[model samples]
Target: MNAHHDHTGPHGASPSGDALPTGTTGFTDEPQITLRGPAELADALPYTLGFHPTDSVVLLALHGERGRFGGRLRLGIPRSPREWAPVAEQLAECLVEGCERRGSRPDGIVVFLCQDPGEGESGRRVMERLRPFAQKLRTACGALDVPVYEALCLSGGRFWSYCCPDSDCCPPDGTALAPPGTSVMAAAAAYAGIHVRGSLRDMEARLRPRTARATVIGQERALDAASAALVHRILDTRARKDVRDDTIRLARMLVDRLAEHPPLADQDTSDTRDDALITHEEAAELIVGLQDRRTRDRAAEWMEGPEADHALRLWRALARRCVGAYGEHAAAPLTLAGWVAWSTADEPSARVALGLALEADPEYVFARLLHQACNEQLDPETLRECLRGEREARAQAGTRHAPGTRATARAAGARGVRRRLRARVGRSRGTAQGAPSTGPGSARPAEASGPGVGAHTGRRTGRQEPCGTRDGGPGGDPSGAGGADGSEEGSAR
Candidate 1:
């Protein structure tokens, strides 16, 4: 999630002279709308988080007397209420400390608990069930001396406030949310060109692996064939470079192919067209070859312009192709998809993709770094500059070295590239003051690990060496690239 405050500017009162609600914030130079009560607060949740959260607990920090919005955090509501207390405590401290590091601790906090009812359960029952969870959140925030001014449970189209005791105003049966696009917050958001990107589940479904049995079988078979053909060459010292080059060549071709065909009006149809554009064999080759960090980093150079727009689509397509035992191979393409999304200012998708990348391989260094950076809201330009520099350095080395000695030069270039990238990453981490840790139970940057072998460990396909490494050649650079991938797995980890 993008933790940066959504609104930061001078405040204005509502036409009725009402104060802005605890959660709503103003956009600079845009028409400001005053959100009056729980109704407006509930309606503004989507705009604040950039999506309609489901099965999630959102905490928005408020600063000063007028309640200007500060940092925000969201986590999936724990299934077991037993876990709610600890989770609430962790979330409160994370958000509060984060705000402090950013310059001021929040003066107040607002909590939103959103979940749809299960089978045979009414919205009121849902609210009643989650009432204890809301109390836990309130107590957690209160423990830190930052009170939760309002706590709401939104379920099945109706909202109930834990902080309000007046049944006449809040209603014991719960009040229905305003019609979409009719709320004052919705109008102001639309005027500012801010759009809610649907529910988190919908955003994540786009990158998930194809689940149809036929598609899975076909894609898995293709992956097996590609692995058989390419793994040996990738492990061969002389052929590794060729494999990397071919991978880059194929990826660029696919990006161009996707760019040539504009997205169809319907997203599902557009995705289907994108899938059809690349043959199963082509996707398998690219997916298998991207295990090489250098190749994936080279492909990441297309992070802007028309190239990025199409590259994101292509990456998503490739991620969907990582099926069956090859599921873990998705870390590469998913990371690329996340990078492109973050670079293009699509934080929701980026977070989803990066989270999925970590799910694929928790030890993935590139995904971890990128995920942390995105969570911290670091300027994507810093990472972009690092990639551009690495590319330039390689180009210079290729020209400077003799043909017979270019391999040595390339190896040196790779080392230098890693150094520069790592330096930039370190600088970003240092500068991101008070940014919450990547996930719960951890407060440090993700640990770096060597590239993981393919997930099909039982098959014993030769020595399961990291990609880009050879028996007697330069080993794979443990520092891969700097970026993360995500999934909508109920948490941003």
Candidate 2:
């Protein structure tokens, strides 16, 4: 359903003078549109979320007397009715507490249960089935002292309201939603350059592992070869810095390649083309190398401007390459994908990717910290500024070393070691010197230890550090080789 603006109100304000809900940056100077009733609210869901949610329970916080929208939370609906009560309580607590942390306790809440009916089931039946769940949600919110203003069930292109009892306006039979792009909200969104980014499932599919048997097998084999070739060297202290440098360099090169080749109009075709650009060997080596927290943070520097756009696509492609036993290794790339998405103001994609990262490895400290910050609606610039400062310090340090100085000699020695390792990897993979490898057995020339290795050398137990420390390099670790603080250190494999 779509919402039409009642033009009687002046300056894009509602009849009550409330403005449209703003994002993380707060209200903007752009004109606001007001929505009235369940039909209009259902129509505004996709635009509010930046995507259409399927099989989801969405709770939106509304503040003040004008019912201005605030933070929102969404989760997949539990399949079992027995699971509804506990899930409802958790969702209610999460939303209310989260809003409080942001310094805005919700004045009221709006609930939306969106799902499609099963075969031979009607929209009315779907509404009836979800009725108890809706009541549980309202009851949970009311217990927190924030009442649910409205509860809506959207299914089969129709909407049913539980708060409104009148049959004339809120009929027993569900009301059909307005046609797509036909509402006043749609027109205002268009004029303001706001576009709905399709469905959540569709956005997530782009980052999932390849399903083709051949592709999966090839990637798995490549990962195995890379793990065997690089894990030991990565664990060695002398070689760790070189490995980090190589990983960052290769990632930059790949980002440039993606930037040069723009995405096609069709998303599927664009993903396929992106997949083709990086060979199985390249993807596997990068994935394995990125298990290093320092390496991952260095790669994260490409989170803005033209480079960020391509870097995000590269991260997504890399995430898709984590297959078989190497699936846990995807935490690095997926976290990077989430960071770039958040930096670019794509909160929906960031949340999905970060969620997947935690699923891959729940103990991933970087992912945990990033996920929490994103959820709190903290501006990503805080992290970005920290990264930028680290990058500049590294640059200045390199320039400080003069010709034939001790630092220069050490830098040259590191490069020579990297060259020797590349040669060794090439010989092991049976590839010619100085040529890119293509076979599944072929691996990236330079490699380092995974995140499981050397990550907590100088870190204190049970303490979590931010993304980057003001004085140290990435991971906020002075040693610059361990995972984020509080993470267990071990072998990546």
Q: Against the true structure, whose lDDT is highest?
A: 1
Off by over 4 Å in 2: 1-27, 119-121, 402-473, 477-493
Q: lDDT per prediction?
A: 0.68, 0.67
Give me the displacement of residue 291 in model 1, in angstroms.
1.6
Measured on C-alpha atoms, candidate 1 has an lDDT of 0.68
What candidate 1 gets wrong by more than 4 Å, as runs, is 1-18, 21-31, 402-493
Candidate 2 local lDDT, 1-493, one digit each (tens): 1122332211122336443432211123334555656677788778777788777788877765566666677776777787678777777877777666445777778889988888999889999999999999999999999888779999999999887666776678889998989876677777767777788778878887888999999999999998888778677767777777787888888998999899999999999999999999999889988876667767888989988999999999999999877778888888899999988878777877876776676556666556655554445765666567556646756777665454344333232332332232222221111112222211111110101000112111222222332112243432334433312132332
**Model 1: per-residue lDDT, tens digit, 1-493?**
0101112211111222336533232244434455566787788888776789887788877676666566777766766667777777777887777667556777778888888999999999999999988998889889999888778899999998887676776778999999999988787777767788888777767887889999899999999999999888776656877888899999989988988899998878899899999999999999988876667777888999888999999999999999989878988888889889988877767877877776677667677667666655556665566567557656776778656354454444444434444554455432221223434322222211100010011211221111121110012233422222111011011
**lDDT of model 2, residue 181:** 93
Which pairs clash inside model 2? 234-448, 234-449, 291-451, 455-482, 455-483
What RMSD does model 1 have?
10.8
